[model samples]
Target: MTDSPVLRLDGVAFTYAGGAGVSGLDVSIAPGEAVALIGPNGAGKSTLLKGVLGLVPQTAGHMSFADADAAAAQRPVHAPDGMVGFLPQSAELDADFPINLEQVVMQGRYRSLGLFRWPGRADRAAVRDAIETVGLGALVKRRFGELSGGQRQRGLLARALASEPRLLLLDEPFNGLDQANRDALIDTIRRLKQRGVSVLVSTHDLELARLVCDTVVLVNGTQLASGPVDEVLTLGNVQECFEGVEVEIDEHTLVVPGHEGH
Candidate 1:
């Protein structure tokens, strides 16, 4: 993979019309690098992801993808078509929906195919590959509601992968996963990195960040600190981001006071 950054944001600010959001942010994700976004509730973590996806408007700053210059003017609302994939916190799929796993993954191709067009041979192949990439090939025909929580998450991940995006954005991807599923998800993320896909994930789990990310960005409505994981995830930075909350640091382990029993 090239050494160029897949995502670049300079002094970016996004806000819902008259609503709270993030601002004055500068961040970059290089090809194959994974960056973890950490913060307390209402810290704009989800807003940042929404801004990148064009679900929210960017009120200020410059954002660009790869060689695409002046993207703020050319493509201000969102990442370029097919350049980014997003996995939201909630899939919002009805467990009773009749759609199968492969059908769900094929939805990722909708942007490229348009509403009138159908999946072609290449699109089908992409769906197959994406499912296999997440180790869900055997469950391709399973109903969406039948899979466990972790399995559903993997299925969503496969849907994201089917887009063949250079950058992937995940918001609280590990929230409901059990240990086995979490381990599998981590392995999947590792494979994505090896394949040169840059990743930006927002999560509360510091251990998860330490395990899968190369960098960490601590945010509280705005970027507090961002750098190599070891530097950015220090006791001081984390506690500062989580203001008023009790945090304990022991070697490489960090425990938030009330969350320790969880």
Candidate 2:
């Protein structure tokens, strides 16, 4: 990792109408590093991600992106094209949409391609590489709706990867996925880190967080703790975030009853 952080959130907060949102967030993501945001449903995990994407309103603090654009002309909340890739928890695309997998992935390039600019050879290459990276090369020609849920999830990830973003944000990606798909996503994250792409994933799976993340941020409508995974994901911290929840951990295992459903 370099001395400069790829992404930074200094005391940042996002507030929704009626006083609902998250606050007191302070995080720094280094190049090639992965950080996990662990919390239960409605704990502001998704809100935090949306805030980074500029979908929600920032009420306090500041954020900055130090990606390809050295001057950083774009505001921190207004993420530039190809600078940050986001895989939302639920996409608005129709299940029976007529689009094919390859076509779906191509949409990610549109921002960089801009208006009236057709995709050149490089764009096609990026689309292919993204599909293969998500292990969905075989299904590139298949109709998106025909694929299984896990396959669709991987396909969407490929769409996000098509942009070759410096920082990737995944919101509850492992949810509703089978063991095989879960493992595949984990592998993909590891590979992305190897390529020096920073990743921030919001999840409730402690095992996944421990396996893939270098650091973790625990939040529940407010900042709870932020630090190295091993130090922050202790019994006390877990209990504090998850009220009345049972947790068991050892050298090789992590067990949380209600939390595992995520």
lDDT of 2: 0.86
Cα lDDT tens digits, model 1, 16-96, are 998799987889999999999889889999999999888889888888778776734445645688999999999788979
**Residue 187 lDDT, candidate 1, scale 0-100:** 88
As a whole number from 0 to 100, the lDDT of residue 88 in candidate 1 is: 94
Candidate 2 structure quality by residue, lDDT tens digits, 1-262: 4557788887889988778999999999999999999876889999999998888888888787774332432344566668899999998888798999999999999998999999999999999999988888888999999998998999999999999998999999988999888888999999999999999999878888789899999998998999999999998788778765543243244444344444
Taking all chains together, each candidate's TM-score versus the true structure is 0.91, 0.89
Please provide the root mean square deviation of candidate 2 (C-alpha atoms, Å).
Answer: 4.3
Number of residue pairs clashing in candidate 1, backbone atoms closer than 3 angstroms, sequence gap of 3 or more or interchain: 0
Model 1: lDDT equals: 0.86
lDDT of each: 0.86, 0.86
Worst 10 residues of 1 by lDDT: 253-262
Q: Please report how far candidate 1 places residue 188 from its true position, in Å.
A: 0.8
| Model 2 spans with C-alpha error above 4 angstroms | 1-3, 67-77, 245-262
Clashes of each: 0, 0
